[model samples]
Target chain A: MNMLEVTNLSISFGGLKAVNEFNLTIKKGQLYGLIGPNGAGKTTVFNLLTGVYKADTGTIVLDGQDLVKLSTIEINKAGIARTFQNIRLFKELTVIDNVKVGLHNGTPYSTFDGIFRLPKYFKAEKEITEKAMELLKVMGLEAEANFTAANLPYGKQRKLEIARALATSPKLLLLDEPAAGMNPNETAELMNTIRFVRDNFDMTILLIEHDMKLVSGICEEVTVLNFGTELTHGITADVLNDERVIKAYLGD
Target chain B: MKKLSKSTKNSLINYGMVIALYVVIMIIQLCGGLSNSMKGFLVPVCIYVIMAVSLNLVVGILGELSLGHAGFMCIGAYSGAIFSKLTEDTITVAPIRFTIAIIIGAVFAALFGALIGIPVLRLKGDYLAIVTLAFGEIIKNLVNVINFGVDSNGLHFSLKSAMDMGLAEDGKIIIKGAQGISGTPQDSNFTVGIILVLITLFVVQNLVNSRDGRAIMAIRDNRIAAESVGINITKYKLMVFTISAALAGAAGVLYSHNFSTLTSAGDKFNYNASIMILVYVVLGGIGNIRGSVIAAVILYILPEKLRFLSDYRMLVYAVVLIVVMLFNWSPKAKEFKEMVSYKIKGMFAKKEETQA
Candidate 1:
């Protein structure tokens, strides 16, 4: 069964269609890539899918649940988690605490349990901490778990964002420009981490990337967007070699 | 045995200050070192501490600037004071009546908090602050026009006049317009105030340290990221705001019961009062619970202590505030503060080991 099916997804701002009639489908455990020019509404598509932007028309079905009209948080609970292009970490919090915030939805303790420090609170908190620590370790961020998130080096901060997203345990993860700031060495490492996450978590992953090298490295299937519409989509090599995608990237 | 975690150590230090302050106050009372005026200020200081700590939950943790905390206090004060008054002749026991009154006040304030928060919390930053400020003004004006009375039949309330309340000849007036509630039972004392502060600390501290608190802070740090992480933003925001308002209401109960007469005007429970409470949170260092307590106490007491400066009293107080703000927030000072706190933590660890 398809893990996600977005059909005729459309949104506009002041008569300009920011994302028009966008459609996508990904099978379970597929590594998908979304590549577009700067103004092609790639981020807007992510926004619509995650409920940040209300669609004018269309449906986002993830694992058979309709995501339209749901709030961002509801969509998240419905198993869609995403990272940002700008790297939004809880900067003042410790790295582990940032991950723990992602683990919050899965914890079963009520507010009363938290305020009273009930046995349930401890049990859930311990499990969350252990899980958060494990994610940090997987990202090679165990040594920096206690450090304030903003204090980390730039590359580690990117890795931390992915680790934090994974802590949400989403059925489908959306990563936005995960390698935007990294060097070649760091980008190679992130590519490995991305594949490792898909295989280990057994989750479908979709990513938006500006780097052709990074997208071609791991994306099994790729979609190209230009001017708020899909230009082409096929296997990675075919999509990259498409005449329309070349024109969209080169302008005019 | 495992060593203490950073959070555990931090909380120990926080509560330790509370206990130490309580001990010092008890010692001073026993030794009769405080003058009459200083003694009079003790309960008010405790009340301010509770208000500041509670306000910090919204201003610091939730990252929403609220300017109508005093409005919640007003709701709490009037409700609590009236409850205590109605039960005065019937209950005959002070502590039980006061306890019930505090709960009533907190519940009413919490209800209003949820009501107002639903609409106002949708706005953010300066807009949120302005709406809350308007709410505070509206509350103050509403209280000014209110006329309430209690009779053998039941309670009566009217906005027009006391005559419109339709009370019996022997009925007692509970609220009389701008004069506010009078003849309220003065059942609250310094000890009781301290106990309530401990309760406030327990609730606020536990909430801050818990997983829920992490979610709230995450929302504060980055709203989009928090939403994408499956956190119910409205739910958490309402929870913190209501809890904060409830605690402010409890503080209002303490404030109301400390005196036989309570008024809601100007310095009492007005806009300035709300801003003053926010000042306590900001000046204390946002998100620093222990700092809020200490700042509220010292700032509340400073004006009284600076009376020796006479005409220049407020000027000196202003200077002190500026100096403290810079010292607390300036980058260089922040580094110095971290170093000093690190040293203090080391000392505390050694002290703990010796005791163990």
Candidate 2:
């Protein structure tokens, strides 16, 4: 069964159609890529799926539930988490603390428990910190866990964002431009880390990226969008070689 | 008990020190050359500390500049005052009556704050500031037009009859149009004030350091990202706003009984008072609890100390806020890094010391 299934999803800004009749499906444990040139409505689709923007039409189903009806937080509770195109870490919070925010849903402590330093609160906090640290370690960010997110190098910030998303225990992860500003070496490392997280965490990832090498190397499945319409989809090799995908990139 | 971090342990010690210091000051005030009238200033300072600290929760952590805080305080004060007056005959015990009044006041204020937060919190940044400011004004106007008084028949009467009834019978109780309410019970003692302050400080301190507080801060830092990661921004924002309002309401109860005579909440809880509390939070460092509390006390006391300045005191107050906010800008990059390094060093040192 598909982990995420979208059908006839559409949104419009006045006369401008941002995304229309967008549909796709991916099975569990799939690593998929969504790519297009600038202003291709790629991020717009991400926004709609995450409830940042309400879809003007259609349904999103995940794990046999109607996801379109859920609020963003509720959708996340149902095992969907995302990172932003522009790295949006909680800049002032410690790196580990940022990751811990992802674990807030799982934390059982109430306000009283935390304030009074109740035993349960401490136990939950300890468990959360340990789990956050483990995610950071897998992402090669264990050493920088105590540092503020804003102070990290750009590539590390991207990885930290992914680590934070992973901390949510998501079944399907959405990443927007996971390698926007990375150097070639940093991008290669990110490719490996993304693959490692996919296998280790047993996750299905849907990512948006402009880098063809990273997208082609890591994603087994790929979907292409152009002018808010799906141009092509299927295995990465077949979709990447589509004439429309190339023309959309070459602006022909 | 779970193992405590050094900072957590130090915070506990610091809280104990503050309570002790306040106790010493109270004793000195009672025993020293200061007269009873001079000691009255402590009541107002404690009141401001509660207001500043509670307001900090909304303004600092939630990252919403709320200008309607005094409205919530007004609601609390007036409701507390009215409740105490209504139940005075029923309950002879002073402290119990006072506690009931404060709780009612806080509940009412929290209800109103939550109601306002629902519609107003959707607006971002400056729009929210303006919306809250208007809400405060609307509350003040509503309080002015509101008619609340009971006659000897124990029947609720309008302002006009209440005044006429006052003059006809024993001229014991009187409240003229826009005039202050008089004949309130004087049961607010320093002990009660200190206890409530402790509760407020404790609750806010815990909230800021908890997962809920961290999520609120994350929402403040990056709304889109926070939402993407599954945080309900609206829920957390409204929760903090209501909690802050409830605390402000508690402060209102303490303020009401501390003063035997008071005017309609219109005069007492105004825009400037809320701004003053905001000034305290900003001057103290927004998210720093100790800083905001100390700032509140210092600012509240400064006016009294410089009473000789009289006409120039307001000017001085404005200048102080401006100077502090301007100079204590965001922490420098190097300093922040050093602070992090220090935390790490301290952590290792504690580990080694514990082992030894």
Candidate 3:
């Protein structure tokens, strides 16, 4: 069953349509990719999906709940989480603290408990720290837990963002260009890490990427978009070989 | 935040020595024949320290510029002052009224913070600043129009009649006008003020270390990324802003009671006070709690302490503030750290060469 269903999603900036009639169905625990050239409205789709920008006309159903009416935090509470295209780690905060932010959405303690450092606060904080550390360890970022985020290397920063998103405990995770600036070796490692995160966390993954190689290597299914329109969709192998996707990507 | 380097630890220990020296100054104030009136100024200075530090949480930690701080403070002060005044006549209701007033003030400030935050926080950068500044003005003007006094007939005193009663002078009584409210009961003491300072410190510290606190900071660093990560940036930001405002409101209650006067909510709530607090945070180091506290104390006290300089006192103050900001004298300042480390290295190098 599809965990997220988007039909005829479109958004516009004044007279210009940024994303038009985009549709995708993501099932639970399925690893999927959305690939297209620049201005294919890839990031715009992510924004529209996350409720950062309301779809001008579309229906977004996540876990059987209509997402169009929810606020950003409400969307998160509804079990959808994502990461940015550019690295957006809290630079002044420690790595563990960054992950703890993700865990905060679901923290069960009250503000009163936190302020008074009551038993619940202590229990909650300890649990959060342990959970954050576990996620960081899974991402191979445990050693840098105490360090400020800006001090981490580029690959580690990307991992930190994923670890943070995972801390939110979402059923479906959206990654926006996770491997954008990485070298080949780093990209391969990221691909492995993404798969590992998927299996270990048991999460449905949807990512937007320009790297056709990474897209084809890890994604079980693929969707292609061009000029804000859906160009094609199917299994990664078959969809990637389609002529429309080729022309949209290569422009022969 | 790391284990302070050995030398830095030693330097911190030296800071303890500086505190000891300051203790001697306090001793001199007590023993060197300074009048009690001269000591009265210390109360406001302490209150300002609390106010500025709490305000810094919003301005620095959450990284939002808030001009509505004084408005929150005004809310606390009025709520507290009214509680104390109304209940003081009945011994049975007085303490409870007073207690409830403070708690009520905090709640009011939080509600106001959320109310104001919804619309104002949607604005980003300088637009946020401008909206907050306007909110402060609106609050101040609202207070100006409000008349909270009851006449001899036991009816509420309107602004026009209250102004005509003139200044009610009984020893240290100090306010009188639609311009300001005076004759407020002076019931705050050092114990209450200090206890409040400690409370504010505790609440702020806990909030900053909590999950919600980090979420707020995450939103602050990058809204899109924070949202992408399911942080619910707006909720967290509003939460922190409300908490910060409530704390400032509590500080205001303490200030109102300490002075036995209210600065006509309209008269004193302005952008200047907000900017002064902002300067304290920046001069100290944004997001540095101890830095903001220390900066607040210095900024508030140094001005009065230098009062003997007469007119030059303010000149000296301006000069000192300029020097601190320009020279980077605060502890967390990069330049200040460099200068101290450079001197420390110089000292250590001499010792090493001499031992060699």
TM-score of chain B of each: 0.94, 0.85, 0.78
CAPRI-wise, candidate 3 is medium
- The local distance difference test score of each candidate is 0.91, 0.84, 0.78
Q: Chain B TM-score, candidate 3? A: 0.78
lDDT of 1: 0.91
- Selected candidate, larger lDDT, 1 vs 2: 1
Q: What residue pairs clash in candidate 2, if any at all? A: B180-B263
Ranking by TM-score: 1, 2, 3
> CA shift at A139, candidate 3, in angstroms?
1.0
For residues A138-185, could you state the per-residue lDDT of candidate 3 as single tens digits? 999999989999999998999999998888889889999999889999
Of the candidates shown, which would achieve the greatest TM-score relative to the real structure?
A: 1
What are the TM-scores, per candidate, against the unseen true structure?
0.96, 0.90, 0.85
DockQ of 1: 0.85
- lDDT by residue (B196-219, candidate 2, tens digit) is 888888888778788888899999
Maximum-lDDT candidate: 1
At residue B164, give the lDDT of candidate 2.
49
Question: Model 2 Cα displacement at B170 (Å)?
Answer: 10
Name the 10 consecutive residues with the lowest summed lDDT in model 1 chain A: A243-252
Task: Calculate DockQ per candidate and list them.
Answer: 0.85, 0.69, 0.63
Q: What is the C-alpha lDDT profile of model 3 across B1-356, one tens digit per residue? A: 65643323543443453355346647867687657755675556557766776877777777887776777878777777766665565545544565566687788878898988887778777888888888877776666655555433443544454554333333111123344556556766655665566677677777766666677787777777777666666777788778888887777777777765676543456777777777888887777766776788788778778878898988998888888886665556777679889999999999999999
lDDT of 2 by residue, A1-252 (tens): 799999999999999899989999989999999998899899999888887789989999988889887888888888889988888999988898899998888888987798787999879988998999999999999999889899999999999999889888989999999988999999999998888888888989999999999998999999899899999899998888988889989967
